[model samples]
Target: MLIGEVARRSGVSARMLRHYDTLGLVRPTGRTVGGYREYSPEDIRRIFHVEGLRSLGLSLSQIGRALDEAGFTPSTLVGDLIRKTEERLNREQELLERLRTVDAAEPSGWQDVLRIVELLHGLGSQSAARRLQAVLAPAEGVSVPAEMLAEAVLTESDPNVAGALRWALARAGGDGVASVASGMASEDVDVRRRVVLALAELPGDEATVVLTDALGDPDTTTRRHAALALGARGVTQAVPELVGTVLTGPNDVEAAELLGTLAQDAKWADRIMSALVYGLTAHAADSAVRMRLTQALAEMPGTTALDTLRQLSRDDDRAVALIASALVEKLEKRLDDELGQP
Candidate 1:
């Protein structure tokens, strides 16, 4: 077949077939009477092979080496091509995400676009100070999208940077709660914890709802943050988790404090107190657990905490009895002082 016929039949352009011939990738096996290049059946087969390699993202030079070099192997070269294609795909995806965030910002002009782009870069900066600056200042000329801030806060690892991002999210306060809410279902424990922390800083029923939903997170830290936040919001649903944290977590002090605050609610007072009492009773068979539970019970309010303390004061464990007696005396005095306040 002549070069033009090859181009017409195989969909290879005539110019490209000539280039292929020049590269010796598919030299024509014959010449026409007019000296036009003519492709043999084998040459056409090589052309199809070149087109196939090109479809696999092989460069023309790479394809030439693949076709010409005795040692060249498609497995190695195809693996390399796959890796390069994946890298390109990742870069393109990153670019697409950046563009989407920028569009979400609804930039008014090129200046705003550039400003938002810089802020986005800073949010992901390796320098903690730069990330902090991004959250604190955001941009003077451009508005940082709330969802963008939510994204930054949810993944930000630095304490200072995370705090600033949360504050920024609150300050930018649109429907960013929904943005943070998405992270609640993340399989990453750190992300769920961070999302709950960010949601805690936000106001509105949406943040409360996000924190409430995060109560069931498998991550203990995520549950702790969510429970404390929800407890502060008077979401009585967090009482059990908060009580659990008080009995065991490193943040038991804070958990106890929040539980105390929750117990002040008339609606949840008895239920919260009962949860503490049950936790104490469940640990009655164990001294150390009982001690922690007793300390936790000290955080409860009303006569239920007082009555539980009284019951614990007569316990068999001397140390628990001692601690419980001391707490009971202290609480009784405080209650007396309050009643006498009139």
Candidate 2:
């Protein structure tokens, strides 16, 4: 079959078929004398497998390797992929557990829906606009309860939610809802906290500005939540304040744990080490925070950071010793891997 007929039959686009050919995922079994490509039934069958694996988030490279390693079927490789996915899901679950107490996830209120929808009215974002359409799509004839509709929107893809609400608001044609969102952005404490949280789930210049302001909120909970939300949003505007807060602020435990978890650039290691040193000198009020910082310090590959961590190996906390043991094992593995030693 030609590419178009294959696309019609298999539902994978011709471009994607060409991509698969390039990736060695599917290949033409033969070519005509005039140079037209011809695919066998076997090639079409393999394309179906390729489509399924792509849907499961396997990269072309990964799918190729898996196909070579397993006997062309993912069932043999699915167990390994499932295990890796489970590990990632476990880490996310743990983070969610820790964050739940810090900030509660409330059901979206009427004003919340109104604000999201109205923002979409002026919505310039293509991604947010598309999301808004999907949410209000079922609203054509079926009257889903307001709360249920809000929940459905909230749970939908983030962009679609933004798009749907904006579409709804544009259709409704109201400025009053914008006033509500803008007013909430100016409020102090809980209202601002909730606004920042909701904005974290949204995408816009306004949400970015609101988040920037929320990080400076007088309430510690609000500030902490803002920091966390902004970090998840990848808004670099909060990094400096978040770093400063983690090093010197009152919420020592949460800040330390987050900094340890989030900070990746080696350039920030010195600043983090200084903060850990300060925490160690003062001694953490929370043992868990102290242990986490100690572990983070141990993760640094430098001699100075290792020496500092080693000095604390005799501390009352057994977790510190375990971290040191792990660090030593890591160093040994690095030497073995680099030196090609057994």
In the order shown, what is each candidate's alpha-carbon RMSD? 2.7, 24.9
RMSD of 2: 24.9
Cα lDDT tens digits, model 2, 125-209, are 3465544544555323322232323223333346446445434433432232232245344445545554445555555566566
Please identify model 2 stretches exceeding 4 Å from their true place: 1-138, 141-188, 233-263, 284-286, 295-305, 335-342
**TM-score, structure 1 vs. true:** 0.89
* Span of ten consecutive residues with least summed lDDT in model 1: 296-305
Q: What is the lDDT of residue 320 in candidate 1?
A: 90
Q: Considering summed lDDT, which 10 consecutive residues are worst modelled in model 2? A: 98-107
Best-matching candidate per lDDT: 1
Write candidate 1's Cα lDDT for 136-242 as tens digits: 77778877789888878778888988888888788886779999888877888888888888888888987887788788877888888888888778788988898
**Candidate 2 lDDT score at position 324:** 67
Candidate 1 off by > 4 Å:
69-71, 265-267, 285-288, 314-323, 333-342
Residue-level lDDT for 258 in candidate 1: 81
Clashing residue pair totals per candidate (backbone < 3 A): 0, 11
